[model samples]
Target: MGFRENEINGINDLNLCDGEQAVNKTELIDHIATSADISKAAAARALDAMIDGVTTTLAKNDSVTLVGFGTFMVSERAARTGRNPRTKEEITIDAAKVPKFKAGKALKDAVN
Candidate 1:
């Protein structure tokens, strides 16, 4: 089958699981086949390199600020308390390392 409705709705057409510019093997191949008019195998390697570059750089706590695109960073979430909506029970949320993105001013302006 192709991509599910929820898997692609309103998401970037270039970054769909089944559209193009996907992060997975099959989708990456599809993307390469279409966008760059490249062979599937070559596209796969390109996607791999892109993903590896992002992962290794982020691991070092360095922000990948794609000026006017956005900034990708790893941030620590301080431990905090939250309530379970269903049970209304208080719970302690453990601290976590999370990948975050803050769109640049240009992006925000474009969105608005």
Candidate 2:
């Protein structure tokens, strides 16, 4: 199947498909378990560990770049206005530090 056919790839895979990389979470767990020869629980833990580790690193405002895969960075989102569609009321969206990934060349090429 084409990479586009795999929705569970990750957020990165999704972006890459739309010229962006977006892979879903489940697929990561499956990949971790299948490739590591570990149980799903173990894989889940490992995946969580990786995510937590990255999150922690980013929390400190440090960037993590996994060579040949992608660079994970913390991005600051400016406060903005938002609307509640149901209530039809305006709201202030607070600024936030968000995790972002820029897919590496290898990953981009592989998808293509």
Candidate 3:
């Protein structure tokens, strides 16, 4: 199955094929458990630990790079002026640090 440009409405429309569905955390945990021959609890714990590790590293303004997966890091967004739709008033948008992810070459290739 393929996606047409007009068919995509938003993130929720990402699964465009019949019998295809987005996999949630529980499904991921089940897959991990079956693949690793571990219990569901262990798989959940492992996933949580991995998430915590990435979060902690990003909190320190650092990056986490999985050789064939992706890199997660913090990116600084500059402050800017914006418009209010209702009032048509000018507003100042504050600068902030946001988390970003860049997929690695191997991950990109796998997807392609």
Question: Candidate 3 has what TM-score?
Answer: 0.79
By lDDT, the best candidate is 3
For 1-112, candidate 3 gives per-residue lDDT tens digits of 2321223333212233455465678767776776678999999999999999999999999999999889999999999999999999999999999999999997697567
TM-score of each: 0.59, 0.62, 0.79
Query: 12-107 in candidate 2: lDDT tens per residue?
Result: 233224544655677666655655679989999888998899989999999999999999998999999999999989999999989899999988
RMSD, one per candidate, in order: 6.9, 7.0, 8.3
What lDDT score goes with residue 91 in model 2? 99
- C-alpha lDDT of candidate 1 relative to the true structure: 0.73
What would the per-residue lDDT of candidate 1 be over residues 1-112, giving only the tens digit for each residue?
A: 2332232444334423455442556854675566677888888888888778878888998878888979889999999999999999999999998889999987797567
True-structure lDDT of candidate 3: 0.79
Residue 30, candidate 1: how far off, in angstroms? 2.1
Worst 10 contiguous positions by lDDT, candidate 3? 4-13
lDDT, residue 9, candidate 3: 35
Superior by TM-score: candidate 2 or candidate 3:
3
Error of 1 at 40 (Å): 1.4
Residue 32 displacement in candidate 3 (angstroms): 0.9
Cα error, candidate 2, residue 18 (Å): 20
lDDT of 1 at 27: 59
